[model samples]
Target chain A: MIKVQEEDFDVGQEIKNLTQENHAIGGVASFLGLVRDIASNEEISAMTLEHYPGMTEKMLAEIEAEANRRWELDASLIIHRYGRMEPGEQIVLVITCSKHRKAAFESCEFLMDYLKTKAPFWKLEETSEGGKWVDARDSDDTAASRWIET
Target chain B: MKILYFAWLRTTIGKSTEEITPPETVKTVSDLLDWMPSLGENYSSALEKRDLLRIAINQEYADPEHVIKPDDEVALFPPVTGG
Candidate 1:
């Protein structure tokens, strides 16, 4: 499952909804991203996330499909939020369920790594001084490249 | 064709979207990039750093060599910063 919205989500409720009927699923791994109150010693008041509407969903679905092909995942979910959000607010979520812990854990990590570099979303931080767009980190590209088949 | 801009690109270009009809010589993403700067100073400034920009055709990532159809939707933006 995938969702792109401005509203916040309940993590516990999402997990329950995905795993309730699945008896074969033995393990679930999830990750939640939150807006930070500070960046580079400056206090951040808010963050505005921007994204391409149709492209965001399409890329997310492709990423999810790749994960399913690589692992034995019974279910997976990715919920990414856009628009203005205050510090400590939930920004994104990724959950993977499998019959074993290893697959669940690894796939969960894989989904996040890919999403960070491949998803069509941008974050602009608003500080006391002014708003600035966050730069893409080289480390993120390195992380995503690790999953490429050699 | 419809050209869309996002984030800082939109801010820099001063518009979110625009419609244009390029000449037949503008066949690919690379060709379009080369010709866009001629439109105005804003386009030239926004697209000055070619490596910093990313492109998508009809919502999918496209390389510089990707062919552009007359009715295609092309988008240009900076690298992603989402989780």
Candidate 2:
């Protein structure tokens, strides 16, 4: 499942909904991203997330499909939020379920790594000085590169 | 065709979307990039550094060599920073 929305989500409820009827699923791994109060020594008051509407969903679905192809996953969920959000607010979520812990854990990480680099969302931090767009980290590209088949 | 911009590109270009008809010589994504700057100063400034921009055709990532059709929807923006 995939969701791109501006509204906040309930993590526990989402997990329950995803794993509700899955008896074969023995393990579940999830990650949640939150807005931070600081960036580059500056105090951030809010963050405005921007994204290409149609492309965001398309790329997310493609990422999810790749994960399913690479692992023996039973279910997965990706929920990414856009628009303005305050510090400490949840920004994204990734959950992967499988019959074993290894697949669940690894796929969960893969989902997040790919999403960070491939998804179309961007973040702009609002500070005392002014609003600044967050730069794409080289480390994120490196992290996503690790998943590429050599 | 419809052209879209996002993030700083949108802010810099001063518009979210626009419609344009390019010449026949603009056959690929790279060609389109080269032609866009002629639109105005904002287009030139926003797209001055081609490497910093990413492109998508009809909502899917497109290579610079990707062929473009007259009806295609092309989008340009910066690298993603989402999880």
Candidate 3:
């Protein structure tokens, strides 16, 4: 599953739904990324993330498909929230289920690395100082590159 | 011809995408960037880092020397940052 929207999601509820149909699954790995409260030391009020409408969905689906191809995952879920969102909001969620713990763990991490580097999302944070655009970090690219060595 | 600006490039351009007929000799992303004088100073300034900008032809990422066809879609975006 791939979703990009403005609404919040329930992490526990989503995890349950993703793993419910497969009773044979022995492991599930999940990740939740919350919007940070700090923006240049100013209190962050909200953030509005803009994405290439059709392209964002397409790119994420391709990334997920790649992950599935590389690992033995039975199912995967990716949810990303866009638009103006306040602090404490859930910005992203990832879930992976497999027959074993290694598959679940590795797939979840692999998907996250791809999402961090390949997903097309522009993040803008609204802080007490004003709205500021975010930049792509070299560390993120490095994180993704690490997986290539495996 | 279609042109797409993504991520910070879109912010600098103040628009997402635009359609226009290419001028004579417009064949590469570099050529298009050189001729985008009407997109505003910020666009010209933000696009300074040609090496860092990952471009695409249609839906696939392309090289700087990639040939652009009349009906092709071109996208310009920085390295993606998300988790």
Retained true contacts (fraction), each candidate: 0.88, 0.90, 0.64
Encode model 3's per-residue lDDT on A5-112: one tens digit a residue. Answer: 878899889888977888888899998988888855777778887776777788889989988888888889999877877788888999999999998899888888
TM-score of each model, in listed order? 0.98, 0.98, 0.91
**Model 2 segments more than 4 A misplaced:** none
Between prediction 2 and prediction 3, the one with superior TM-score is 2
For each model, chain A TM-score?
0.99, 0.99, 0.94
Chain A, candidate 2, TM-score of 0.99
DockQ of 2: 0.91
Instruction: Report the C-alpha lDDT of model 2 over A80-99, residue by residue, as the tens digit.
Output: 99999999999999999999
Question: Per-residue error at B18 for model 3, in Å?
Answer: 1.5
- Model-by-model DockQ, in order: 0.92, 0.91, 0.67
Error of 3 at A15 (Å): 1.7
Score each candidate by Cα lDDT: 0.96, 0.95, 0.82
Backbone clashes in model 1 = 0
DockQ, candidate no. 3: 0.67
lDDT of 3 at A147: 84
- Clashing residue pairs for model 3: none
